[model samples]
Target: MAQFTFEGDFEILADPQIKLVESALQKKGFTNGKIVVEPVGQKGDNYIAHVKRFIYEAEDGTTFNMIGKVAPVAEQLRLMMNTMVLFNNEIVMYNLVLPKLNDIQNSAGVTDDEKVRFPACYGVVTEEPYEFILIEDLKEAGFEMLDKMKPLTNESVRLIVKDLAKYHSLSYVLKNSEPEIYESYSNKLSNLWAIVGAEPEAQQFFESGENDLFKMMHDVSDQYKNVVRGSLTQITPIAKKIQSYEKGSKYSVIQQGDCWNNNILFRLEEGKPVDDVMIDYQLSSEGNPAADLLYLIFNCTDHATRLEHYQEWIDYYNETLDHSLNLHGLKANHIFPKDQLDADLKRYGKQMVNLGVLLSSMLERESKDALDMRVMTGDKEKLWENTMAQMNASLLDISTIVKIRQRIMGIIDTALEFGLI
Candidate 1:
């Protein structure tokens, strides 16, 4: 992890970056300003970007707060992630896809309160190899991330899935009404799963797959190690299948792709999450709606919650999506009928099992070491060695191990039930 303090690293701000900010603020009616940029989140957490909180004070004493997300300054990191097509997709998302979705919702007579909200993008620099987007700071707008350290309750899960339904439904409507536009948008996006799955390092890691993390599952089942191994091996095949965009698929939409607790921010009222917004669209791509739902379920909820109310949660998502589709003068049957949605779940559910094993371990692990490991992109053996090291460190925590086991077992059970294993 690199140390980035406001005082020592203030010189890192280039004149061009400041100029970009000034141009963006001028659009919002701010004239002649003094701009100060400070580091915002953990530098280790964001391996691909330099996230800065920008404070612009106008000559008239008016102030504007915006987030400037810029590409990594490190040449090696930037080149590696760029080859994987990471940063530019987000630039496309905030600039193109989100505004289009908002317009589609507005035309459908959806109220602002009910609409799926994205932060307002003030400006974007789409120059290749130096992409960044400036959007309204959600924290200043009263939105906060659910504590990543705490387990999510049923209510938080409900809000997350419900919001995801609305987000997916708009794309459904667009796919049905204007296939060309939807096709173009989906084509422009990248499937992040494919990038990771296609990595020789990842595949080799899956092969050499006896995990210390899985050792903690001794009380759970004898098959735990094999289940983890087999699921990881399947990531590449499933990702290739999804990214193929084969003909005769009944439905697909541009998913947020990354759906962990960190990427989602919520608005709280009386200590409960009332409304939520999603951020970090670098992984956005065309996929089954089930991809997003099952990912959220396995990563965010406990085993008991899913076992008890899985069907209910699925129904709720469909109902919300259906209602939104109806408001847009479209029938759910024409866009995403119930039967197709069911098939999608069965087909794509295995991918969630794969993701849960990898991501749950990641969530529980030490953050700084994990970021340090990310730089070893090309070395398959070294990356796997470091990954196992991180997992071993996390296994020392009994509570984290319990949660990891619960999630892994739940996913494995669901995958078996859905005939995905």
Candidate 2:
């Protein structure tokens, strides 16, 4: 509170959470400075946590910046979002998993340019309700999140999967090199959907959304609707199967888990891809590596792009994964063979496409219609306990519906063509 200027209502951070930030800043050598706190990104861009940018104007005129994923102050929303599990998963990734991964690459003398790039964690506070992850701001390095509604270009997709392969290689390294340590992380990450499936309230929330999705499919033929249902309605059970400890653990790697456009940030140089980093690990879980590719390919790119490069992207990811493993003296065939990867894709492909359909709705929502967020906020919940009246309003937009429809059907088409479904 001394020299900190809260740009908005985030001044609510006057609690012990503020002290955590102050301590991290002070440790970084900013003994005397003004810290400006403000929110980052739009409503639809992020939902689980409030992403805030903290800028410290040091006495010497150089400003230091950090990004904080802060829990909402509203307890009702906190319970609904289950920040307890989500934030704890992230804190462990930053505090435990990623550091171990960095050590493996460093010991191998991997160059910084070739290693998996993640933001440096300054501090992590997993104290319930007040949980937040404080890390270096990627924006300082010119990294930015792509537009959620648009398709990622082939070049951009290459940069994404290339980094994904490298990051996943570390997972295999940690698993083979230090099995005990890797198992600990695998045990720690809770399956978000498995938890949702257990809670009646959470189940209702998704069931409502699922109902709307089925309504959208009313326009399609029964053959295609069955294809849609193969994954869509079975979401919870399929996710449980994938995230469960027994599911393909031999071939599993620490997947980005929720691999979508919004969770990845790219640094563009003159309108083309240069470097990119994956952010938001709340859903990070141990699963078949194929889950990441299927999720990203279906959810991030358009049908046209996937048709031209779907098989190529999978091969590219395999090549890159093998190369990353080779850098540290591990062999992909010895650990995750190409045949196994293809089998995993066939096994998990439809379930992952189901994820694309669900994410497509939320991520593709027009800015003006993203107000379903109101249902999550306590204040809005208080006013509208019976909000079914406005439930499908956003999903009703013609253009938004088209995007969602195309993604759903196109996802199925590609899977069918590849013999995955």
* Best candidate according to lDDT: 2
Backbone-clash count (model 1)? 0
lDDT for each residue of candidate 1 in 232-303, tens digit (9 for 90 to 100): 677777788777853225577888887778788888999988888888888788887888888887787766
lDDT of 2: 0.78
Clashing pairs in 2: none
Question: In candidate 2, what are the lDDT values of residues 54-153, reduced to their tens digit?
Answer: 8888768989988888876677766666678888889989999988898998899999889889889999877777888899899899998888878999
Candidate 2: where are CA atoms >4 Å away? 1-9, 245-248, 371-395
lDDT scores for all predictions?
A: 0.72, 0.78
Q: What is the C-alpha RMSD of each candidate to the true structure, in Å?
A: 4.4, 2.5
Question: In angstroms, how far off is 10's CA in candidate 1?
Answer: 4.8
- Clashing residue pairs in candidate 1 are none
Worst 10 residues of 2 by lDDT: 380-389
Question: Which model scores highest in TM-score?
Answer: 2
Candidate 1, superposed: residue stretches over 4 Å from native: 1-16, 43-47, 82-84, 205-220, 245-248, 366-403, 413-421
